[model samples]
Target: MNRFAALEAFVRVAETQSFSEAARRLRSSKSAISRNVSALESELGARLLNRTTRSLNLTEAGRAYFERVSRILADLDDADRALGQLQASPRGRLQVSAPMSFGFLHLAPAMPEFLARFPEVDVDLSLNDRFVDVVDEGFDVALRIGALPDSSLMARRIAPIRRTLCASPDYFRRRGTPQTPEDLKAHECLRNSNVARTQEWRFVDENGKPSLVAVSGRVSANNGDALRIFALSGFGVASLPTFIVGADLRSGALVSALDRFVPQDLAMNAVYPHSRHLSPKVRAFVDFLVARFGKRYWDPDDGRP
Candidate 1:
């Protein structure tokens, strides 16, 4: 028995929870995959999987073994990728995760050029607003916006994410413009329900002091694009990222306020699992993003008051 092939078969079967699926992924017969996994289990004198007629579940030992074995496979793949980096081009499927709004407005548009540049690379892009576990989800890299928490994953800043307070001109006309952060309390504000403390908006005052405002609104949405739509339709004042509202602000569909108090700036980042040898596809994609948006090119100068 090929020990490495058996290990790969076991890992794939554990991940897919099906001999057939594992066989398909590994490009082998189901019998072959089952034989390899059975051989591995026999060698270790442990039943790695608890199989039922309709379902397959990992035994406790299997779970622990899967964790270690997956990492080992990843390291081996990284070693291969490191050697391949010396070649002229990167060739592989790059799985990337990005926020819905940014992926739609920015990243999606840039893909054509990237694909054109790297003919050998294939991209699998997942657009979601929720936080994704990069390693567990098996993503090559994830594009994240805003302040990142402490994590073991490696991150590279692709660009600065600037946010602003904005509303439709009609709304500002109907309701007087706010002169101070305290004034937000008197007006309806569009809140993002996805973020922590959805009603609390943070800002930096002119004197470089932090100011927290407890804002309220009749309408709240989990998505920034939804909030931007609400703000554009004269629903209320929405604190939104410039990337979402830059075009509208420039076109007079939305106008920024409170230019004196700077909104907290976040960063667009590419995060990947830390590996001794980074994959060339991940490296190239991150580099492409840094070169594309490093200068805040998407921001509009006249968006603010």
Candidate 2:
């Protein structure tokens, strides 16, 4: 017999002081209940009940074990109830890792609304441009941009991350816009140091064939926002995500360079440890992000942008 089942039957029989009453409460046969209690007593090497013709009674040993076992069962039930409640509602501290620039410029603004929708959840957000191991770092979820490497973790695409070669209007006016990918060689390009090929910028032609252009820049920074600021200050052209430069492009603070040569659109993905049985907080947040950004709302061509 299962230990838990036997213990439960023993506890119920002790409480009601009658096998018939315990069986009725448990919706089981009285003989099955008696057998379970007997098995439990045999396992414990002690008599648990004082059987009589008229009434049932608990032995001293039975009474002692009942007190402790009843408390344990109650606590177990409470824990199960708590877990069910948590599954039903997103409540608890959700640990998240995200890129510094995107976190501040995008996610930070959307968080207030998410919190408003799920008031019981608190977000513990960490912003850094470095790659974080979602499982090893103990993050409940992570937002990543670009092509993801092969890993054990599961990912869900949240938005399209479109890259554009752009510069501030002042810089473009001074240097003139690059009409083609090769033309960028003559311009003072600002490089994002984080990329694998710091000096090469990629673009796709009209035929959808991708090409890499070798270029040099005076300013190179590891962080995208730093490169963005340099471009804003009219330093040079930079390849940046539309999510970062979309507002500027709309406001005429920046202008798209080499518009004919389209850059490949990457993806913004929400990564977690596993796909199955995800916690309520992580699932809610990822779903929220998908609904909020999956349509590439940051694109200048988008009506809202």
Question: RMSD to native for every prediction?
Answer: 2.7, 15.5
lDDT of 2: 0.85
Off by over 4 Å in 2: 1-87, 302-305
TM-score of each: 0.88, 0.70
The list of candidate 1 runs beyond 4 A from truth reads 38-61, 302-305
Q: What is the lDDT of residue 157 in candidate 1?
A: 94
Global fold similarity of model 1 (TM-score): 0.88
The alpha-carbon root-mean-square deviation between model 1 and the true structure, to one decimal in Å, is 2.7
Model 1 agreement with the true structure over 217-248: per-residue lDDT tens digits: 89999999999988989989998888899888
- Local error of candidate 2 at residue 29 (angstroms): 44
lDDT of 2 by residue, 74-95 (tens): 5676566655755588989998
The deviation in Å at residue 155 for candidate 2 is 1.1
> In model 1, where is the ten-residue run with the lowest total lDDT?
81-90
